[model samples]
Target: MTSPAELLALYDSQQRLVVPEHPPAGVTFEVTDGVMRVTGRGEGFVETTQHLGLSGGELDALIAKHRDHFAARGEAVEWKTRAHDLPADIPQRLERTGFEAQEKEAVLVGHTSDLLVARPLPAGVVIRETNDHNDIVGLSTMLSEVWNDDLSWLIEQLEAQLAAAPELTVLFVAEAEGTIVSGARIEFTPGSDFAGLWGGSTAPAWQGKGIYGALAAARAQRAQQRGVRFLQVDASPESSPILQRRGFVEITSTTPYIWSPSAPLGTQS
Candidate 1:
């Protein structure tokens, strides 16, 4: 069992090291006014902040700066705020500055050992890990249905990452009768004991049949096999109770604030 303090420390350290507000390939990343801003491809955001103790005037200026940065690119920006972030009033400041708060999520952490318990898979369901192009496409398609959005961006991003650093990301899918029904991915951070679980989704018809639990168990086993000690997820309300039942404890909360241009640039409104 991991203590809350230990979990917080782990989260902070990982954020500073592996998951810092750095840009991925083809994205422009910059740091100004203690904020890390990233702009790219219909997506822009303040990825991280440091030591920001600003007066209201400064906050307004900073907000305008971010708005201009994304407006020029015609992208919607998301600022991810954690409960433990410094100055304590950042979320309120963001709301006042025109950022709309999205859903709040529980930051759940658990020891890999606790998550490795065996679970029986539903009949005709098969779980496998693969990097084959077809498998990636299938996984992405299943996720797109689950998320009700075009996840082709995710497919491209995953392929790029896998090509560059195959070991850094792993994709798992649950198939029934040769058709993909559920999927998820795990990202291993270099030089850290943490592996993040993301994109865990099941087809609507496939939910509540133990496919998700089976996927969780498989990912946990893989994490432990990779010598990772901790597994972390920013869990949605629907998934929080499921994970809690599997030994994940809530460590913190996170909310994403989004800002989009009134009309996307280059598009007729």
Candidate 2:
């Protein structure tokens, strides 16, 4: 049996590499010296996933350089600093400066082929395949409405990714009355044994409907179809229990630490 702590470590290790190789297609990164700064133009919901690898000083400078960009556009950022390889006072620094620390979540994962995805969903909820721009746009729009984040960037990235690697990725949506209620993206990480279930979200009016879970199951089913063995996600508290109920286990907690010179020093939201 795999312990949660061990699983957490595995998740942490896998996530640490997310910045290096598999950054979201919409985000852009610029490296200077030993620092890498990542910025998402329209898809800047979680800054932690966007930017990786910067010393304290480097982060401060990057924040200063991009302060106007963020402010001009009125984007809220959850700057995440990992607990490992970071300053002890990083959260304090973030708070002292300006950024707010939000709830921390554990990365959770399971065997794709082992997940029992046939959970009961609320009535009128249906999962369906999405391949065109309109369907993709609708999914993105619903997610944005749920989280209040822009989806144009996320949609653009997904479009490019789906175009390039159709075999490795599948995007799905849950709908009611022809409007999207929940959505998820399942990516079979190329050249690896793992497939990821990402961006699981449901509309506010549709909570407790199991739409998210059903969509997750659909993604896992897709993964099984592709012969992948592992399914993974960085889950918030709300979704963690859902995954756990379906056989996913908690891995290590992943805290994203962030700093910008013009704003707070360290913050995670």
Estimate the TM-score for candidate 2. 0.72
Per-residue lDDT tens digits for candidate 2, residues 1-269, read 66667655555544433443445455666555433455674423333422345647655555444443555655545555555434355456455446656677766778885564566987888888787888888888887887787766667877877876676678888888888888888876565557788878889999886677678778878887777767878788888887787788765555653333355434333
In order, candidate lDDTs are 0.78, 0.65
Count of backbone clashes, every candidate in sequence: 0, 7
Name the top TM-score candidate.
1
